[model samples]
Target: MNNQIKLSKEKREDMIALIKAYFLKERDEELGDLASGFFLDFITENLAADFYNQGVWDAYTYMNVKIEDLLEIQKY
Candidate 1:
């Protein structure tokens, strides 16, 4: 069992940046190829093992969080 480790704001921001960079990089690439290589190159990569080691398996958990934040956005 893994104990939950608290992340500093800076650390959390860094992890978010890492995720964005990864997605942006793959955005222009072939989805099929990237999907096939994702398991090893992204999933098992050092960033995964070091930070997001738990893996984001809960789709709704992620989606709801995003939706909630988006809903809170104020349109000028």
Candidate 2:
């Protein structure tokens, strides 16, 4: 599996801003734009796949439950 994740310019900026805000609020430290960008890139490359898989699993579970509920209602 490819380890690289691509984000559009707007999305990249948004992520960087979020990272900066997180550090500022949670760590009480200022994170520079370049540092935040690097951090975002590193996380996306290393952990995005796992996050994506978890999201897919969550969606599948939700859909399965909804389908079961629909099926039960259909029997009424």
Report how far off residue 20 is in candidate 2 (Å): 1.3
lDDT of 2 by residue, 1-76 (tens): 5657789999999999999999999999999999999999889988999999899999999999999888886643
Judge candidate 2 at residue 64 and give its lDDT. Answer: 99
| Model 2 error, position 72 (Å) | 2.9
Residue lDDT tens for model 1, 1-76: 6544555767655555565566669775333434444433544444554555345546658888999999888797
What TM-score, to 2 decimals, does candidate 1 have? 0.33
Models 1 onward score TM values of: 0.33, 0.75
**Cα lDDT for residue 6, candidate 2:** 80
| C-alpha-based local distance difference test score of model 2 | 0.92
Predictions in order: lDDT? 0.57, 0.92
Off by over 4 Å in 1: 28-76
Native-to-model Cα distance after best TM-score fit, residue 27 in candidate 2, in Å:
2.0
- Which portions of model 2 miss their true places by more than 4 Å? 1-3, 73-76
